[model samples]
Structures are given as C-alpha cells and as structure tokens.
Target: MSAALKIGFENPVAQSQAVFRAVMMALARPGTVRRLDVPVDAVPALDPAAAAVALALCDYETPVWLDPALAADLQVQEFLRFHTGAPVTEARALASFAFVPLGGEVPALDDFAQGSLDYPDRSTTLVVAVEALAEGEGWRLTGPGVAGEGRFIARPLPADMLDRLQRNHALFPRGVDLVLTCGDRFAAIPRSTQVDA
Candidate 1:
C-alpha cells in the first residue's frame, strides 16, 4: 500500500474511540498531559499526536487548514484526506481545525475563527506540534479545570504565547482552543484557562 494510504487507526472504531477519550480528558483537565493509547504512524510533516487528532476528530464536515510545512507535503495532505475525509482549506478563519507542524509558523490568534457570542463552539481548534511537553517552570495555568494552578511547559513556543493566551482567555466563550502535541502525547488549553508567564 502507498504511504499515504498506510496511516490511520489500526482498528478504526476502537482506536479512534480511545484517542477521542484521551483528547477529551486532556481538554477537561487543562495543562495536564495525556498519552494516546494506540500508536499513530507519523506522516511526512505531522506528529503522531497531531495525526491522531485528525484521524479521531476530523471528518468530511470538518475543514482543516495546514501550516506551510504540512501543506507543502503532498503525502501528509493525502494521508489526512484519505483517513479523515476532511477538506484542506486555504483560509485559516474558515477552518474548524488548524494543523501546525513543528517549527512551522503559527498565525496570530485572530487569524482563526473565534466563533461568536451566540455560538462559541464554532471557533477553530489548533493542533500544534511542539518540541516537548514537560513539567516544572513554564506557563502557569489557573481557572475552571485547574485546582489552584497547573504548569504547562512546551518548547519552541511563540515569544508572545502568554500574551496571546491572555487575550484568547479574555474572549471567554468566543476564542480558539489549542492542543499542543509531541510524539504520542498531547495537552490542551481551552479558551477558559488563564495563562501567566
């Protein structure tokens, strides 16, 4: 089989379900890292966790936008299209999910859809590939899911990540959400969470 056709959940139904749970739990407990139960073979310019997110959460109804690095890779595009049936969109604001490969340039928070006052769920969800996910000195998180505070440390983050996150959080119900991925591990920081450097 071609490489593009080779990447997807080993057991479509069961594995996707597991990945879905892991994703939800990551979001439910902001700043907490979760590892995917099943392995997702890496695509040309995509991380395993990012691939898992696309396979498990995206479909024909969900349009995805790929960063420059990922968009330049035909095999990565074909793999996502073949497995998820999600159309690749050029307009960032119109995408339901945006995938950014490691070292890829991330657009400004306002570049993506921020939903609206009446329907906040319409906002975009960013799946960003990072160098690593670790504990210890990093951005401090609080609010909603966090008890008192939570630590989120991912390398190669945008210099103004905390500022951007603060602005996103201020948007409350109408802001983009982020999922940071590395290898097979992932973590989330919803719009409801507050970030402090």
Candidate 2:
C-alpha cells in the first residue's frame, strides 16, 4: 500500500461531535448552508468538507463507495482506512455512502441503494463535492424543514439532477439523501424535500 495520507481530526472525539452537529442541523433544515470545523489539512483528491463528513459519520460498520477518480487514488483510500476504518465497496448499490466529485458525470440515482418501503432509512447517502455552495436562485426546496421555501444554488449540477430528485421524492420513504459539500461547508437535501428548478 502507498504511504497513508495525513488527514484526520486532531481531537477526534470533539471534532467528530462538532461535525456531526453541523451535519444534523443541515439535514434538519434542508438547503441551509452549514460550516464544518475540523482541525485537519485537506487531502489530495478529496474536498475538505467531504473528508470531514467521512471522519464524522463513517466507521467499520459503514460501506463507502468512491467515485472513479477517488477510487484510483491510493492516498485517499489509505487515509480513509486509517482514519475512519470505513470499508470501501465496489458495488454502488451496496454502499451506505457515496462520494461523488464535481465536474463529472454523476451516477444515476437508481444505481445507488434506494432502500425499500419497509426500511427506507437503509438508502445510501450521497456526499457530493461541488465547486461552490450558496443560497440563491437555482432550485426551490419545500418540505418539512422549510418554513416556507428554501433556495439553494450549486453550480454545474447534473443536467437532470432536478428531475431526478423530483422522481426520488416521489418514491417517498425510499429514496437517497444528499449532502452537498464545498471546501469546509455543506448543505443537506433529504429524500423528502421537494425540488423545483
């Protein structure tokens, strides 16, 4: 194996708590941007926020699926294994979580684990690394979390992302959730959220 990349929280327990809280808040209030504060240098081929999320949420019990570029990077693989102990999977449908980089052709929503009507929580959670994440005009989100409507803007999303998300929402309690990451910030879009582009 290649030399493991240096990346992980300086104070693993405390940092993980902070990251978890941020992620929880983001998921609770879908489309609300939140910052993740972890004391770790950025790893090559992985976004800082994405790395933070992995360290916060993944463990031996979780199966992670890396996108093509990340899967080819030994440094990232080693770093994740050493720090998170999360196993990597070759099957997208079996992944508990998936890391998808920006500027690539995102995999089809159906390619991932959509869970089942009886156990919707078993669906995969997507951590999408984007070039930028902001609150503005692009997609209008409305659901349980939003007081009225939530607006989120991320550049260079998949051409059919909105349509796909809509379809996913239609699946009700059986679709995947999404977490958009950029640098040290992120936002969530649960499967229950309604997306209008």
Candidate 3:
C-alpha cells in the first residue's frame, strides 16, 4: 500500500522574496507604506509582523536580539535559528541586524548605532516591531527622502537619542539605518533622513 504525504501552501523562501520586494518598494516610495501578512502567531513578542521581518532580512550574516521577556523562549529562538540562520548577540555590540522586542518603551536610540563620521555605515540597522503607526503624532521628520516636512509620534523617545541622531546627520551620508515594523507593515528611515525635534 502507498502512503499519502502532507504539504501546505506556505513557503518561507517565497515569503522571503515577497518581503524583499515589499521592502524595496517601500524604499523606492520612501514615506509610503505597505503591509505583509507573515506566517506566525499572535503572541507577546513574536507576532506575524516580526516573523515577516525575519523572513525578509535575517540570514546567516544577521544577528538578532529579543527582549528579556521573550529572549529565552525556546520556540522563538529555535525558529529564529531555523529560518534566519542568525545567531543572537549582545545589545552593546551591534550585529548586521538588531531586533528590539521592547514590547513597551524603545531604548535610547544611541544605545543602538548612530554610525561614525568616517564609516557611517558602521552604525547598526534596527528592526523594531511595534504596536502601530500613525502620522502627525510622532516625531517630526525632515531632510532627504521627505517632502518638506513630516510628523509622527513614537511614544516618547529619549532626549539623548535625538541628540545622537542629530550628530549622525551631521555626517550626512554616514549614519545608522532604521526599519520600523508594525503589525505586517514596515517603514525604512535611512540615516539620510533627518529626524527633528
């Protein structure tokens, strides 16, 4: 007798490609936005959006970090290892990638990377999975990629962090990159874009 095998419609590699395309489109559009439904559960830290971000950016070259609340969860860690093939790293030393599952308050942005005057690219790229995104309520954005000016609220960022980013912009082309992941949607705010207080 022959046995039947089970197969499902979800393919991570395909999802990864779609994610890449979406991210590219977002970059091309700049302030524009897009959403993706990733394969994952609705949980404390690891949500569908978070999973989608991993699918798009995380790979062997990337390094990941989870908040203490969700860091040691075997399922989360193993899934990250299995899919992204990335290793976990310390918060102080930046890896190619970083995930802030803060789940509450975002840390001081400078704690991450603001880049150096010489090699601004040396700064870290941050992936923050947050609750939501809205306009005219968060921080004010100006400079490249933006029209005249834009405003958005992100909780309440630390004063020092704003200062660091200001310094990063002084370097112009050299500075840290940002990707804000909310739900299944994401926005990349490259260092080239200036955030004004």
* lDDT ranking, best first: 1, 2, 3
Each prediction's number of clashing residue pairs = 0, 0, 4
Is candidate 1 or 3 superior in lDDT?
1
Residues 64-163, candidate 3, lDDT per residue (tens digit)? Answer: 6565555666666666776667878766347666667646445555566555667666666766665666655556778766678876544233447567
The digit string of per-residue lDDT tens for model 1 on 5-92 reads 6557778898889999999988889989998879777575788889989999999999999998888888887898788889999999
Candidate 2: Cα lDDT at 40: 61
How far residue 26's Cα lies from its native spot in candidate 1, in Å, is 0.4
* C-alpha lDDT (0 to 100) for residue 33 of candidate 2: 92
Steric clash pairs (candidate 2) = none
lDDT of 1 at 4: 40
Clashing pairs in 3: 137-153, 138-152, 138-153, 139-152
Best candidate (score: lDDT): 1
